[model samples]
Target chain A: MADVAPNKLRLLKGAVQDNVDLVRGIRTPGLGRRKLLESPPPDPVQRKRIRRLWLWSPLSLVVIAYLLLPSPVVSLRQTAPIKTFEAEIKQTPATAEVKVPETEPQAPASEPHALDRGVIPLAIKKIVIDAGHGGKQPGAISESGVSEKEITLDIALRLRRLLGKTPFEVIMTRQGDQTISLDKRVAFANTNKADLFVSIHVNWTEPREIRPLETYFVGPSDDPVTIKLASMENQESGYSLSEYRRVLEKIYIDTRRDESRSLAKNIQAELYHSLKTINPELDDRGVKMAPFLVLVGTEMPAILVEVSTLSNEEEVQLLTNPDYREKIALALVRGIRSYASNHNGVDRKGS
Target chain B: MEETNETFCVGIDLGTSRSSISASNGERHVIDSYVGWPVDMVARKVIKKTVLVGREALDNRLMLDLRRPLERGLIKEGAKKDEDAVQEILRHLISLIGLKQKSKNRAKLRAVVGVPAEAFRNSKQRLRSALEGVADSVMLVSEPFAVAYGLEALLHALIIDIGAGTADFCVMQGRYPTEEDQRTLPNAGDSIDEQLLKLMREHHPEAQTSIHMIREWKEKWSFVGEPKKPVVVTVPVKGKATDFDITKEMGEACESILPPVCETMLDLLARVEPEYQENVRNNIILAGGTSLITGLSDAVQKALADLGGGRATVVKDPVFAGSDGGLALARDASSSDWEKLSL
Candidate 1:
């Protein structure tokens, strides 16, 4: 102070005094309503500082609390539905919706989805690919530690990727390893106005080593083994047959069954042909009918494909290999592509 | 009787092979008592699951460390891992009936559990310990007493509770049954299964079968008297399933359990007071899972006919008898009878 000029010394003193005043105001006793009873009101600066520091205290505490929570809780908060909503996301405008009609109870029969025997002349605007046995239910296990769920998921995902180039709007029943009920899967297909439903499953049997690529449409079958397989699949539905038999019967009256069978045949054929290059002995178990709960109540043509048998040691080895898995995936894609290409030109009404 | 009110109370018959849960909330479920945890990280990834319960666990036993925690009608002691497995099982069971099926009213649960008659103190403690944070209040009851309480057969009824681990017997005389009125036979479902497996391995040496396969055969075709359609089942040989006749082995194995059960039935009948002995003999109740054998009751009755005139009646709902009885006990349990645990 002694070395400084007069104006500079005054400015320094004023700065010290202002900071002391700010500090005094920050720690000032009775800065609250109690102070109003005894002293003058806080000046504008003190009020502004108090507003900046203390007014948003509750919100600050909340933000801190949110940051401190567990990771799963944070993820759950982010992902859980705020409310039920229907959202449609399309990279390209879905132009084929005009060609396909949504099935109602009294709606006139449009061409059914010919997945197997022949193609129906119709545009498939939407498709649903169902990957079976997710979450708590891991469908089947193989000696090499491969699971049916993984095989189904991998194939479904690969098919989706392959079909991404097409104009079809592909919907997945599940995109991850999680459980979705059979009823829910059916509801999703029906509600989405899906033109076709393709359910993927890896087969299993008691004795093992039975490898085959089989496909199914919904109905009664003469084969006891087919009947047993239907029972096995329906057991997971957690519903009595009597509960859904009437509904299934009513749906059977419609033309969806024919389309489903056609679709199954096409897919089965493609699967056999596509995999012949890699494994010449791949068995084509042929398309058959069975009362699969997943196939029930879908307004569109639905088929459940037993892509391969997990019980078969040879199939298990093939399934574990990424290169072989891609071949299997390509086979499924070729089957669908064949049906799609054929269906585009065929006339509806069983032509 | 204390009313169960809207409070959700459950009765659990946690058997060695199967477990049944009957809740006051109108839910009755029976599941296999098989629990499996993935063996390794690869198994865990392949299974895409951590712990599998019931039939799901049984199906994926290859990639899992399958443990049927209850060996002889009681939780296996001495292993912390087994104890943990039992805890996981109880936890899964409680969640199955409580959270998933019934969404509303997730209040603290009260449970009444049935163990085989004359369970060791350590076994009871082990079971009780397993229920640590699962139930709010729990009481351990004998399998037969639970059935008696559920059936309202508190007096002059000889209850034979045959299960996977042990055949438990208890005679009721208008009060809580004691050790004197109860007898536990170790030769029950598992013993018969073991005998059947041994027989299959010895006789049909070419047939590829496991204890699991044998258990399936026993469950489907086991009989104590006349053969049921030859019990011809397909067993894999060199990865090919071939039809094998296991009728004689199954019949013999089923009968192996009969001598012990009949002997115990007679012994318990003799212990009843002279005036009530005849009534107890006439009102024999055959309960438990193994009691579902096609001709078990008839065999017991035939063996008893040699001693005196008696009847062996099979309970209609064998799976739920213990659980239903346990639920009834939970409803009628005095507040002091339960060991209350904080939820």
Candidate 2:
């Protein structure tokens, strides 16, 4: 019984060795079935001991058979159909009895180059200036009788002239005093691929006394005060076009909102600095957000400037001066230039 | 300047009679729109806090000097006596609205508040600054526009918001309304209450009536034109039961509130284009608590008909309609770029 126990142990060892050989042979690179057979068994004495246990101990034989048989079958079951065909070779009598040696392969020593060569350049090519109101819509009438349409147009034209020397191509949503719809203004920017959009107007107040310089951005996701101003400016141009409406919806979903915000901040900063420098008493009114129909559907970064309160007597008087208009235009141009210089690598993709 | 995706937006409806706040992340709450202060040392000793706000302040009328922030639906900014009361009320109201929530930090707060349509420019700014202290962003829209946005009627619709102090009218033209589209009239539920108080004093000299009692009577039996049954009430005059006739007085008082409402609606109707005129007429929606008056719709419709020819309608749910509309606008506006709205 003691001899039988040692023989059983030898037989189990042999079976385990055979399983390892078969797994290694199948996994070994470039080795075929014939090559596996060319290798000799580890020892003759061990083989005899395993053979003796198989002949004498029936219980050991049954146990060894029970463990060894299922492993190959389980491995075969687990492997994919293509691998199963390769695994079948290990179950063959001659292949199942041998041990196979594993080999290590060395990798070659050359460094690979990057797929992308260098950084890409993003340049502002075109800008769209949208004068908020035109034609039939006179917009807010100042105490001094300055119309919102006239102020916006004056500012827009000045901005266009300031950008004339720059690389940026300038486009005006409305060149003359003609009524242009909000949708049309947005469409012009989208079609032309305008990098930046600026709509200009003047602020108004009830009791015709309050005066301030405010800027607006569109809302839904934009700030409320800005949206109100934009809405107020857009109200002056009442014409609504369905074609631009679709484009506007698309622009709203685009990822340019963040960039638009950055542009707004820069413009607000520039405007605030310039306006404060000119008149310390002038209310900074700061920057606000709103859902302005004109700004809403534009693909580019957009801002609407309420230069000064047309309702205020002093402000309206100043607004009529070419110097004041020039100062506002110069301040806006400076703001746009600063924004463009800082965000040179960002893709504005304006027409 | 801090833009975070997790920023929360808040919509607050600071009504003349009551204030409610709703959050973009789904929270809606209301607080009484009143502030109170202890009148004397005895009252101050009874209540440890120097001030009280909302329902508690309103209920404790005798010991506290109650003050409403708004008069005739506009903030009484420079009023001398109610300074402390207003500030305390605002602080309490802001705290209750959870202005200190974690969302206040990570969330970009865009607060849309409803003010009277005809609010002065300076008054709007003062109100904006007041709200801005508690919010990251503040947007002041007329009360009627908020109601219009609440109802999703941005185009070809008229909003008639009848609150305690004023009736605000606005015409929606497929966009956020401009100043031209809005009008406010300083005649509403409070006006009716005042009329009732005056009429009762004239008719029943011995009958006792306070503004509160008159307001309660107006809330209970206020109607224009006629009611199915006449209203009779017993008054406590010098702690004695006194029967009074309030039917004619209530009807007359309620009727007096209509002229301004009709006149504003007519003005709003005339401002819109002739083509959209019929649509605006058909889509006239009445909102606010005062609009809950029994025969208001029919009477207002009759009034409109008398002006020219058109239809007028009241919203099915007046109480939550304006706030709900503001909430809807906030939800729709959650993904909007805040910078695009600044002007």
Candidate 3:
């Protein structure tokens, strides 16, 4: 009887080992066939044992499934429907009366049309327009006697006029030619609760031929081409090319960069569309991202626009023309309008 | 002796070059020792602020009268008006460690501030006054003792604190430091920087050099003992290209500060009990920012070996060692009656 008990125990151990091996084979990739072929089939006694195991398996499965599955009672309590019902029952008479008005509109909404469904607006709201290089900062006088500051102010005023007609309110950081520090400009946008900000400026190059209408946003993006364009727009007047390049490369991994790229793309698309309609020969200077002090610490979507290259003689001539100035303003207005329309329900007016 | 924890204490390494504060709440932070005030109404118009502290003030020094209050290991009376700025900086630092908030009632602050080893009583009084409003009580201790406390070497130990402003030494005899056990010398990291500046001026007369540029060079390449490579640095001077030969120049500048350091160490060692002198020598621990320079430990060890009596060792983490010691003291003594615990 003792010998028979030891044999039975050996058989049980063998069965458990085989089950472990089966599980291991399932877990390992490309080893199932080899494991199955190497193992012998069950003997007569083992076969009988296996038959007995099959008989008990359903009962064991019931126990295991109960242990493994989440409790139905706990799940019922956690369900939103149950929670909402409980919340309704717990509400005071005053609170319940307040909630009654919310459900009154539902009486006529049994079968709601798809068009009646409200759209979720974009998160953006107020926009602060900073016209760079105003007052004492004339900022790059062109050969044609056009000041960059004057051109920026003209475009900014036009942008405000266009944005005013839209649902989004417009706030000009500087409404007239005024000297505002970079820090103050960013602070003004932040303090006034401006949702999106734009700073307008005209660019210049040492060589006369380099002319491009560029728009800038802060930080870099996944798109390398856009990053390079942004770098070109951010270059300081006297800084060597290598120094500027190094600065761009250093800030490439900055994570808050996607916001900048999105703003740049929106502004570039609108500017290019409007400018191309007026002057096909005007350089399609693409959107770029760079570190600009005026754009820093602005808790909203911010951009800086380089309207035209003041260094180029032909571009300078166009900048001085009153009609061209109005066209530039119109293009900025179109950009602001597009941005505002996409992001509805936000107050864009200056605080 | 084991006792109940009742005294919540903090240790502050209030250095002339870089100041750090550590509390029992497991925080140790460092800030540059600088104070800034607006030059005039015109300057405020440009900067938009009346005062700036630490690195920001140093960076925009063109617009502010930057005063480094602690000069050569003591508070210069001329710069004493900066006490308000210093207090503000300390207040900011304390708030960073989660103690200054009204909500935290875990402990009352009893601080032991480590000043220069040989600081005058007047300077110590000034330090105490600076800490008066910020802490419940403040105690002034020698900087080297604070370093030794952090190391847990209470008996027969020597500490060399090579700070930017001064090299300080203290001999521990299982008690708080006395005047006899402490010594200080003024030629430290900042002194080395001054010497290097003078050298650069003599070598390259046309260079538009500032102390900032010299300090940058020192941080990058300042070394003593032996040269691994030629230290040739290309510095922009007046928007023109210039390469300065700094191999020998840097070596001389760094070495000039060593004589005073060694002398202070020897002076402190002589003051220790003769029977425990050997033990103190073996337990010599080098600490502070200047000790972070490459090969500084080796140089100190070699210098001491030349004296032929004992060995010297450097602390592995000088940056946080003093603060951690103060924290440990705070935790251990926190249960003692607040009135009984000395600040």
DockQ (C-alpha based) per candidate is: 0.01, 0.01, 0.01
By summed lDDT, the worst window of 10 consecutive residues in model 3 chain A runs over A25-34
Q: Of the true interface contacts, what fraction does each candidate have?
A: 0.00, 0.00, 0.00
Rank candidates, TM-score, best first: 1, 2, 3
lDDT of 2 by residue, A1-351 (tens): 123233232322322232233223221112111121212332787466435433443443232233234345335333243233223433433222111112211111111211121133556778888876765666887643467777777678668766775788887876545555565566678887887888887777654656666665543322233334444554533232333234333322434555565576677678778877766668765555445666667766787777887777777766655457768888888888988887763443221
For candidate 2, give the lDDT of residue B243: 81
lDDT of 1 by residue, B1-343 (tens): 3434435688899999999999877788888898899999999998898899899999999999998998767777456777787777787777777544344655557787888775543356567768877776667778887898778777789999999998898887765454456767777999999999888889989998988988887888889899757889998899998998788988988899887677768866775789888898889998999999998888888988876788889999999999998887666544443423322
Native interface contacts retained, candidate 3: 0.00
lDDT of 1 by residue, A1-351 (tens): 244334333322322232232223221221110121212344898467445434443443343234223354334333222101001101112211211112311212222322443443467879899888865667887764466776787778667756765788888887655555566677778888899999999898656655677888765443456656765665446333333434444333445676776688888888888887777766667776666777866778888998888887777767654456667777777777778776765645346
The candidates score, on chain A by TM-score, as follows: 0.63, 0.59, 0.54
lDDT of each: 0.70, 0.63, 0.61
**N/CA/C clash count, model 3:** 11
Off by over 4 Å in 3: A1-351, B1-8, B40-50, B101-107, B271-275, B333-343
lDDT for A187 (candidate 3): 63
Residue lDDT tens for model 2, B11-70: 666777777777655667777778888999999999887888888888887899888877
How many residue pairs clash in each candidate at the backbone level? 7, 46, 11
Candidate 3, residue B110: the lDDT equals 69
Worst 10 contiguous positions by lDDT, candidate 2 chain A: A99-108
